[model samples]
Target: MKLQPSAVGIVVADMAASLAFYRSLGLAVPDEPAPHVEVPFGALRLLLDTEETVASFDPSFTPPTGEGRVGLALECDSPADVDTAYERLVGEGYRGHLAPFDAVWGQRYASVLDPDGVGVDLFAASS
Candidate 1:
């Protein structure tokens, strides 16, 4: 048996806000009222679905109420870029989970929560 990574899924409370937040990070997502929306990344797809969508299919399904359900790391061109991206998202009203800092592991890293509270990480190799 073999396993392959296919997609990253996020359950959102508000489609517009979720789409806006992702667009700020350069994803070209279209505005649609459909319960689900997705953007392609090479061979993988980043998928977003509304809580209502899940419950419609699975009446017993319960959406997660805590953090850490998802962790998405985005690479920047440079350490400074990581800082810039983090600051931009924060300025746009996103929650900054962690300020940009140089990790002893040899990279600049930071975290921000999307509109739906999913962790979106930014990182770059220390130069």
Candidate 2:
């Protein structure tokens, strides 16, 4: 069996706010506005949808409770990239959850929260 991961869906309380927040992080927004938007990132696309839209597909679907913390993990090319990305996120009005720092494991990483309170981690390999 061949399986490939195409997209990851995130439920947001406010579509526009979430879209704007992701766009500021360099993710491309769809040309048209809808309840959902697909953002292309390298070989993968992230599907961003409103909570209502997601619930429509699965009535039993419930968004993770408690601030929707810990959403996505994105890897960067270098430790410097982590710092740069974190800076950009902060500039775009994202709340900085954790400042960029070198981990004991030797990876540089940082965390930020999107408009919907989803945590995104930026990490890069250290040499």
lDDT of 1 by residue, 1-127 (tens): 9999999888889888988898899877886646899887557899989999989998998988877888988889999999999999999999999999999999999999988778989999999
lDDT of 2 by residue, 1-127 (tens): 9999888878788888888777776678854558988899678888888888988989898876666454788888899999999998898778999999999999998998988778888999897
Provide the lowest-lDDT 10-residue window in model 1.
33-42
Candidate 1 TM-score versus the reference:
0.94
**Model 2: pairs clashing at backbone N, Cα or C within 3 Å:** none
RMSD of each: 1.2, 2.2
Q: lDDT value for candidate 1?
A: 0.89
Residue-level lDDT for 113 in candidate 2: 91
